[model samples]
Target: MIVITRYSVPEADSVAFQTDAATAVDVLSRRPGFRGHRIGRAADDPTLWTVVTEWDGAGYYRRALSDFDVKVQAVPLLSRAIDEPTAFEILAGGDL
Candidate 1:
């Protein structure tokens, strides 16, 4: 499973946002069902950032949300994500 969360950040807050995102990733990486993650800023829109995380499954992702560290260190940053569908199930893939 993959979760794609997009955030709209103002240029003035980019530094702080990146810092918090790094911390969020660090905290989440320590969680048991976390596969990996990637942080990205849109080439066309610098203010648009994304946090993509691969998880073992939806359950693992949900459980991670309930974790203490996640709630403290990550939830604040995650709460800024644009309201929309974020989680996805892999149905097909290919090497890039």
Candidate 2:
């Protein structure tokens, strides 16, 4: 399973936004079934950032969100993510 969240942050808040994203990754990594995670800024648009996480399955991803620690440390950043579908299934991919 894949979860992708996009964030549009002002230049002034880029550092803070990346810090929050890192915190979110740290928290989520502790959850069961977490495969891997990555955070990146768009090459053409620096203000556009994304947090992408791979999980064993959709259930693991959902359960990670429900974790209390994740709620406290990650939810704030995640809540600021663009309002759109974030979860997806991999149709084809190599190890990431």
Candidate 3:
């Protein structure tokens, strides 16, 4: 499964957001069932960003969120994601 979290950051906060996002990714990477992740900025909108993470499954993703390190290092940044569904069940043919 994959999780896509988007955020709208002010131009002044870009650098800080990037640092915090990287820290979140690092903490998440140490958890079990983590697959990979990417941090991306939209070409058309510089203040728009997304954090995409792959996990072995939805369970793993949820469990990761409960970890103490993850709660401290990642949750804060993730909490700022746009108020929309973040997780998606990968389909047979391709992504959602």
Candidate models: Cα lDDT each: 0.95, 0.95, 0.96
Task: Give the TM-score ranking, best first.
Answer: 1, 2, 3
- Give the CA lDDT, 0 to 100, for residue 82 in model 3: 100
In the range 1-96, model 3's lDDT, one tens digit per residue, is 989999999989999999999999999999999999999999999999999999999999999999999999999999999999999988865454
User: How do the predictions measure up, each by TM-score?
Assistant: 0.96, 0.96, 0.95
Clash count, predicted structure 3: 0
Error of 2 at 88 (Å): 0.5
- The clash count of every prediction, one per candidate, is 0, 0, 0
lDDT of 2 at 44: 95
Runs of candidate 3 exceeding 4 Å displacement: 93-96
What is candidate 1's CA lDDT for residue 64? Answer: 95
lDDT of 3 at 91: 81
Candidate 3 lDDT score at position 94: 48
Question: CA lDDT of 88 in candidate 1?
Answer: 100
Report the Cα lDDT for candidate 1. Answer: 0.95
Measured on C-alpha atoms, candidate 2 has an lDDT of 0.95
